[model samples]
Target: MRNPAFGHRADRTLPRYFYVLRNRDGEARLPVYWEPRPASRDPLVREVYRVRVAGRTLEAGNLHVLGDRLRDALGSLLATGQPPRFWLVNGACASPVYREGEAYVALTDGPRLWGKDLAELVGRYAHYLASCNGGRRAPVSVALFSPADLDVHWPELVWTGPGVWIPVFGVDGRLTAFGPRDRTWSVPAGPGAVLELWERVGNDLVACGLLQHPAALWGSEVSDSTRGALLASSEPTGLTLRFVHFHPSGAGRVTLPIRRLEGRVFASCGELSCLHVAPDPGTLREYLSAHLAQAGVVAGLQDVVLEEDGGASLHRLVRAERLPVGLASSHA
Candidate 1:
């Protein structure tokens, strides 16, 4: 059977071939390899290239690792020669086979490349290939997708929104806009409705976690303090929604009112003060870092919390709400 990791041959043509090379110390290393593109009517070349160890040849042991090495080597060679526009990997393992009179090889077990995790890996490989193909000036246009079309493109979630034009940061940490500027961030008309957008910084998608409905607007009888207490409490009665939008600097902008209540004893009856605080910058920064890490973009939170004191004095008390549970469940 042809190696699913590499490819097989048909009609005696080796369409594609890959080989692995190990150093004398038995450490796997990535290097360059070259071979003549096979003619259309030749059996596939099983041994594309050999690794030399002090004038001796090395043997292939682990086929999977070998395939990875071969891929890396081929990538390096392609960089020096006519680089490919883009490259992708399915992340599977299989043996190699040759065909009669075929110069090209085809990969088997292509189904292994199917799922969300595998698709992401394939995307990463494509990104690596693009980098090797050329400099940033000649960017390789590539798209990543899972086996099913229903799977949302990861970046798309962070870059685009419903009706609002928000800014989004690119993979390179530059900010860009999503949609046209004339669009308004509209909130649904209901007891508790809100609209949300997100900004992307690095690989992260940042947006407001939740926006209460019109009935839960800031101030009024349902004061921010009361809402905060309710949310923090074990039993949160208010309806909450999350909104996310991308920023131009690859960072996301999240806006939500922080509500908490404090009480003071008066000569007649105790008075209640409502306090509304903004999202914590530190928490936002941490969230962004975590999100980007999955995309192979590692970033530290430079600033997470941005505090704007509404000039209200209030005491801090944790409320018993299901919000924490909701967050945990969503992450899970």
Candidate 2:
């Protein structure tokens, strides 16, 4: 059966706003938010979408207008400071939200979708509507940045006009993180999210082949026993990367190592964190087996020693596995 939310058969029209666009499956879904023509508008000539909120109903031509009304109704409380965070045609949100550096921007679209293994926040429609209009929803999503996480990682919230932007990388030399934004983090970020940034730094360094050289490990010359010993040590030999997937909530993040790797670069992934998270951290024979098993990636381990002091650590990565593709982020 056709979903009526798309619209009535005679005058089928769909809502294009963010919230209405995503269905229960968290896939692309269109709902009949409002129609082009009026069935019985309090107005005789213009068409309007009748929106219901907190037992109150409103009529407007589109979500933009509807959002404006919501802003006025819930003044002084928009995470977005200037105006409502409501948007149309993927345009910039009208509000001037928080400050990241010198820029002030609104929330725009968030808690955005992430990998398929991630699930949507579970909550009532009322809370969703309230939060969308004004950041009033609680317990909806896992904290992106917990207080403990924040102490370890500093956030770089940048404003790019309509919405706020998050920076994913910092300059050390030549490596650039594959992407700048966390697609999943478009929503209200938790303090824990800062960890994601650290992990990305590691992932990118490995991707660029900067930290791929084994020589970076045991010295100018690579030693067989050294390689075997380093790989064999299980006691936090080095920081490792991990992509944790929650069961139902459509939220996911890149977690970082706590000890010394907090805000460091991936060239230092081994020196800071352990290499346990690296895929091919095994010895010669074991590595060859892993490399052959996963032809998609060149599985290998490399140690990087970069600190004011002469400290080093082990690192490894499954190459070519971009976050979105490797994580299967393209579905419900």
**Backbone Cα, N, C clashes tallied per candidate:** 65, 27
Query: Candidate 1 residues 282-321, lDDT tens each?
Result: 3433443333333233332332233453431223232212
Q: Which candidate is the best by lDDT?
A: 2
Positional deviation of residue 119's Cα in model 2 after best superposition, in angstroms: 19
254-318, model 2: which lDDT tens digit per residue?
22221222232221122212222222333222332232223322222221111122223333322
The alpha-carbon lDDT assigned to residue 162 of candidate 1 equals 22
lDDT (0-100) at residue 103 of candidate 1?
A: 21
Q: What is the lDDT of residue 101 in candidate 1?
A: 30
Q: Which stretches of candidate 2 lie over 4 Å from their true place?
A: 1-46, 50-278, 281-332
Q: List the candidate 1 regions with Cα displacement exceeding 4 Å.
A: 1-118, 124-128, 135-282, 288-305, 309-332
In order of appearance, the predictions have TM-scores of 0.19, 0.21
* lDDT for predicted candidate 1 compared with the true structure: 0.27
